[model samples]
Target: MKARLMWIAGSLIVIALLGYGGLSYALRQNPHAVLDTVDRIAGPSGSVEQVAEASTGPHRQQRLLVYRSDDAAEALPVLVFFHGGSWAHGDPQHYGFVARSFAEEGFVVVLGGYRLGDEGRYPAMLEDTAAVVGWVHANIAKYGGDPERIFLGGHSAGAYNVAQVALERHWLEEEGVPESALRGVIGLAGPYDFYPYDSASTKAAFGSAGAGAESQPVNHARAGAPPMLLVHGEADTLVKPRNSRALAKALNEAGGRADTLFLPEGDHNAPLLSLANPWRRDPLVHDRILAFMREAAKVSVPVQPQTP
Candidate 1:
């Protein structure tokens, strides 16, 4: 019996290692292609429309994609989401599954594309995000969304970007939008407090941005910041759960409304992936986000209690 148990454990270890190796190779070869393949397999169930083309920086432009429900006559809250790829590579097309799910849930969803780390550094991606928000603020009404009921959300590095924009306020201000323009922020598996610039990706993306401390969202948390919903996976090996805990604690200490949801069985991508077809593990991620946004927008709707 002991020998059989050992064999089982050894086989599991080998399988795990092989899975990790395969994923690493796929990501290293072409991260976007990997995401595209997943998205194609998931098959987004809603419609997406390209709303506008905007400049990210000098000589560079990116398009904005908006997802809306079939019933377009009613004005609904808008959610603008940013994708995460360690600030290096990600496209709005890769997140259609997320956007479509939110759209199906009675909210208009916008996905913004930005220049990657190699294409631009530090504030470039932030600026592109702001531009997308600015466009949504100005033109979302045409797509059956309320301009005043805008929210921001992202995953991983994209969550860091959303937090920076929502917390710092200057990025949006530069785009002629007030901080009050946002109803709330949702961060999934975000590295809100990581600092010291130890990793190669961090160095490449934010090394020249002055102090590494300045790039963190925790440093910028203050009173009157938009309400936040930070969700992290307890099992996430990539970005520690402490990042979300610290950010939520800071926001609450600073007199802002912040809530956190920690998924016991989830890994780094679980929070966002729950929005895909047939939420399996962390089913409450979507409901929690929608509840938070609806409450912020002052729109009355019945929300079921979040699953533990």
Candidate 2:
């Protein structure tokens, strides 16, 4: 009996180690490749039009991909999404699955590419984001998007960029755009309050900016900022959920409208990856996003279930 109990315990230990190893390996894989695989499996659900030369960056000109519903005719709400890759990787191409999911739900989605970590840092990413937003504002009407109902969102590092651009005001001000132009901002598993450059990636991206607080979105939270929807998964181990909680708290204290959605079962990547077909589960991330946009834009469009 003692021998049998020992074997069982040993087997359980091995299984746990193997599971941990697999998850670690998955998390370490190239984010771009991971997103590409997801996109391929899910496939695009909307029509894609590429703006090969939408905005110019310090290194090279960037492109913007617009996702529009096949039957979209009238001006629709716009969602400009920024992809997260630790501020170093990821592209709009890898996010077609997400963009299309939004497009299918009656939104004209814009995915913009920006300079990454080694390519650029801090304000450069912010600059590119602002330029992209300006480009969308100026050109989205051609794609049947209402400029007045433009919303911005992103996951992880991208979310930080979105929050910075929307709240800091200077980035948009430099682009000759007003804060009021944005209807709302959304952040998913964003590191809005991470500071002191604990990680190499964070240091590489934001270390040079003296007084790290300036780079933190929580530091900039105040009244009159666009309404924000901050979402986080309770189980996220990458970026802590407290980042969202802290930012939301600050926003509310300042009399700003910042709503938070805490997913009891969500993880760091769940908010983004759950958009994929077959991988999608109940309480779809896309639905919550659309609902937030509808309420903020005050547009009463019926939500259409995404076809898997």
Using all chains and alpha carbons, the TM-scores for the candidates as numbered come to: 0.82, 0.82
Residues 153-266 of candidate 1: C-alpha lDDT, one tens digit per residue: 999988988899888878888888776668888999999887888777788888856546877999998888888889999999889899998998888777776788999988
Report clash pairs, candidate 2: 88-117
- TM-score, model 1 to reference: 0.82
Report the C-alpha displacement of residue 67, candidate 2, in angstroms. 1.3
**lDDT of candidate 1 vs native?**
0.76
- Deviation of model 1 at 216, angstroms: 1.3
Candidate 2: lDDT of 78? 90
In candidate 1, stretches whose alpha carbon ends up further than 4 angstroms from where it belongs are 1-61, 280-282, 299-308
lDDT (Cα, 0-100) at 132 in candidate 2: 89
